[model samples]
Target: MRAALFQMTSGVDPAVNAAAIVDAIGRAKAGGADMLFTPEMAGCLDRDRTRAAATLRSEADDPVLAAVRDAAAKAGLWVHIGSLPLKDERADGRWANRSFLIDDRGAIRARYDKIHLFDVDLASDESWRESSVYGPGEQVVAADTPWGRMGFSICYDMRFPDLYRALTNAGATILLAPAAFTVPTGQAHWHVLLRARAIEAGCFMIATAQVGLHEDGRTTYGHSLVVDPWGAVLLDMGDVGGLAFADLDMGQVADVRGRVPAITNRRDIPAQVTLA
Candidate 1:
């Protein structure tokens, strides 16, 4: 399976972000990517609560999603429309960080709302309270693709290893982690964390990211990456806006598991208590 990781620098305007994504999808198709995955926040990253709320659209009303569905059909490629902000009127008008999987026929096969909400205070004085303006999702989603079962996850979800573990155990050969990692954490832990996840799960990890400062003055650590099942870095781009394509040989999953069968060697024994 040939996959393309489309790294992007999405601005605050939904229209501009949509145009950028359409072009990237075309390029990925031209480069022979059977499937394409974009980074989190594919359309607009406005931090302002009022602005974000005002711009939110339902799945049926989202124009960006419409374009992506059409583009996937035109190129005859499976596409993962990274996390989009969907308007939710229940929480005094909030948004849901949602993702969509488009089949080759340009029809949405599955949708996943981001289950983990990022409500942390970063060291860069860059604090984000995603739950304050966005409602958290309860469902964990996986899509069946031509290649294999592809698990869906957004930015902050990468830090949680159990999610990936569950995915791989549930017959997922590839896990997609589309993120908008901030500068501080991305610089320190991004690559190592990604490689570790791939090694532990024995799965191909595709991580596309936002590469630079956004229109909201939020700087994202943009090192998009692809890691093999054996904890090897296949591709890593530092602050570049483009697609990273790699041939995912599903056959390697067997070899990697033979080498280090970590996933299957778990013991449910009680943990040793620390001397408090």
Candidate 2:
């Protein structure tokens, strides 16, 4: 499968971000890409909640989502919109960090709200409290595609191995992790964690990321990567933001799994462990 990964520096305006994605859809199709993957917060990346709230909208009302669906349909291309921050319907009034899988016809095939939120205090003095604004998702999602069953995740979700194991157990051969990572953490853990997940699950790992400085006065480490089931880095778009492509051999998943057999040999751990 030919995949196009868009690494972008999203700003406060959803319209501007939408335009970038729309243009990328055409470019990706022209490049003979069957699917396009975008980074998390592709709609808008605003740090200030007060300012972002004014711009945030429900999924049905989001201009970015609307535009991308239209563009995807026009281009006849599948799209994995890494994640969008949308106003949730919950009584608590918290929002959702949602990922979407759009079919070639522009229909929403599946939606996955981020199960794990980034709540960390970084050594670089950067801190995040994602749960303070976004409610956690309860479901683990996987959807059918031309390539194979694809698992969904966003940003901080990469740190959790159980999630990937669950997806692999659900018959997913390709895992998607869209992220907006802080430079410090991205530098230290991004590649290793992504590779580990792919190796452990014996599945392909596609991680498209947000890169460079944004309008919100924050910098992101932008190494958008695609890892094979054998833990090989297929493509890595460095700090610069643009469109990059990778050719995936779906056969690799089965080949690697047969060689390692990690997933088949996995034994469930008990909830309680006795002290050694």
Candidate 3:
């Protein structure tokens, strides 16, 4: 299966971002891509809490999702709108960082909210308290598609290897980590972490990311990538707004697993603690 990953520098307006998404969909279709994946916060990006709150729309009312869904239908392509910052109905004031998997017919096949919030304190006063604004997701997700059984995750989830193991155990052959990662962390650990996940799970790992500076003054380190089961980087779309393409060799999953079989070799051990 052929896929296209969108590296975006989204702004505060959902409408404008939606238009750009539609255009990218068209380009992906033209490029003979069967599936298209986009970066996190493709719907909108704003640093100011007040402005971001005002701009967010409910999933039912989001124009960005509606536009991309329609575009996918028209082109007969599978689409993953990596993550959208939406108004969460269940939570009173907090929002939802949600990801979607759309079929060729424009139907939503699966939905995964970002379970891990990016609450971290970086150097030089660069910090974020994502959990304060967005409620965390409770469920893990894996979806069946024409290509393979796809596992879904967002930005901060990359830091957690256990989640990827769970998904792989649940029959995931391809893992997606769509992100809006900060420059410092992305530069330091992005490639290493993603490749490690792929190597461990024996699954292809794909990460579409947000890049460049936004209107909100936040900058993302964008290097959208596709890693093979052998921990090889197939494609890397650098810090720019564009598309990264790659073809999946599904047989590699079983081939690599047959050799290593790490996922199948399991042992449970109790932790031993000695009083000091």
Candidate 4:
């Protein structure tokens, strides 16, 4: 399968970010890509909650989602919109960090609200409390694609291996991890974690990321990568934001699993263990 990855430096404006994704859709189709993947927070990345809240809309009303779906249909390309911050209807009034899988016909195939939220205090003294604003997701989502069953995840979710194991156990051959990572963490752990997940699961790992400085006065570590089941880095768009393509061999998933068979060999861990 031919995949297009868009590494973007999304700003505070939804319209501007939508336009960039739309353009990438057209370009991906023109380049003969079957699917396009984008970074997390593709719609808007604003640090200030008050400012971001004004731009956040429901999935039904989000202009960015609308534009991407329309463009995907027009381009006849499958799109994995990394994640959009959308207003949630729950009583707590928190928003959701949601990812979408749009079919070639512009239909909503599946939606995955980010299960793990980034709540960290970095060594650089930068801190984020995602749970304060966004509620955690309850379900794990995977959807059928032309390539294979693709599992979904957002930024901080990459650090958790159990999520990927659950996905592979459910028959997912390709995993999507779109992120807007902080520079310090990204530099230290990004590639290592992604590669480890792919290796352990024996599945393809696609991570498209946010790059460069943004309108919100923050910088992101942007090395968008596509790793094969064998833990090979197929494509890495290093530190720059634009459209990049990679050709995936779906058959490799089976080949790698046949050799390693990690997923098939997996056994349930006992609930309690004695101290060594």
Tens digit of per-residue lDDT, candidate 3, span 17-115: 999999989999999999999999998988788988888888899889899999999999999999999885454668888999999989999999999
Q: Pick the lDDT winner.
A: 2
* Better by lDDT, candidate 3 or 2: 2
Model 2 ranges with Cα > 4 A deviation: none
TM-score of model 4 relative to the true fold? Answer: 0.99
Residues 1-276, candidate 2: write the lDDT tens digits: 999999999999999999999999999999999999999999999989999999999998999999999999999999999999999545688998999999989999999999998888888788899999999999999999989999999999999999999999999999999999999999899999999999999999999999999999999999999999999999999999999999999999999989999989999899998999
Better of 1 and 2 by lDDT: 2
Global lDDT scores for all candidate models: 0.84, 0.96, 0.92, 0.95
> What TM-score would every model get versus the actual structure?
0.94, 0.99, 0.97, 0.99
**Clashing residue pairs in candidate 4 (N, C-alpha, C atoms within 3 angstroms):** none
**Candidates ranked by lDDT, best first?**
2, 4, 3, 1
lDDT, model 4:
0.95
Estimate the lDDT of model 2: 0.96
For 1-276, candidate 4 gives per-residue lDDT tens digits of 999999999999999999999999999999999999999999999989999988889998999999999999988999999999999645688898999999999999999999998898888999999999999998999999989999999989998999998998899999999999999999999999999999998999999999999999999999999999999999999999999999999999999999988888889999999899
Worst ten in a row by lDDT for model 2: 88-97
Query: What is the TM-score of candidate 2?
Result: 0.99
Question: lDDT tens digits, residues 118-221, model 1?
Answer: 88987768778888877877777887887888888888888898788778768887888889998899989999899988988898888889988788888888
lDDT of 4 at 11: 99
